[model samples]
Target: MGTVYQINKGLNRPISFKGLKAQYIAYLSAGLVVLLLGFTVGYILGLPLVVLLPATGLLGGGLFVGVNFLSKRFGRYGLMKYLASRRVPVYLWFNSRKLFTQLKIGEGYGKK
Candidate 1:
């Protein structure tokens, strides 16, 4: 017999965009799209090219660089891990399974 195989083997393929590996492609593409949309919307809104060009350039550049830096500093899984680590907690509780230790519809956690 050969090596064991997973049932969801298709999911194991590395995520990529264009020829670039990992999330770089996604970041670049999204940045470019934002750049284009910024210009288009600015033009339609009658903003001057002088201001629009620089503003869009900075916006797009910042997004592109930010994304690239994030991806590089944190590998595929690391990026999500980084984000999760910084997220605020939704559930806060002590030891007891008292009256308000569960999730509520519109009320704050641990509060009535």
Candidate 2:
């Protein structure tokens, strides 16, 4: 007998795992990978296991906490929207009106 697994049928829903949603999962995974690489490099370079172990453990714990916090605070797409909002300028400082004036209905600049 073969085992059957239930598939997700939600339409356009963000992927989530263990309360971590969408990009937060990726963030946590990447952080863990970086910590693993750092630990490996430190070990190869002869750094004591005591130091590497504690440091890696602390970093991994921090990564999990931070990612979980972000996931909870900013729903699925809120984080991306927040980041995009930061890129918007507070005020537009146009030096001159020439740029706007040159724009005409159905015509290019300096063209008949």
Best-performing candidate as measured by TM-score: 2
Please give, for residues 11-96, the per-residue lDDT of candidate 1 as tens digits. 66767543444776777887798789879998999999999999988988797667767766776678777777668475753456
Residue pairs in collision within model 1: none
What is the C-alpha lDDT profile of model 2 across 1-112, one tens digit per residue? Answer: 9999889869899998999999899998889899999999999999999899999999889889999999999989999999987887868646689988887786765567
Q: lDDT for model 2, on a 0 to 1 scale?
A: 0.90
Q: What is the C-alpha lDDT of each candidate?
A: 0.74, 0.90
Regions of model 2 farther than 4 Å from truth: 92-112
Distance from true location, Cα of 25 in model 2, Å:
1.1
Stretches of candidate 1 off by over 4 Å are 1-21, 87-112
Decoy 1 TM-score against native: 0.55
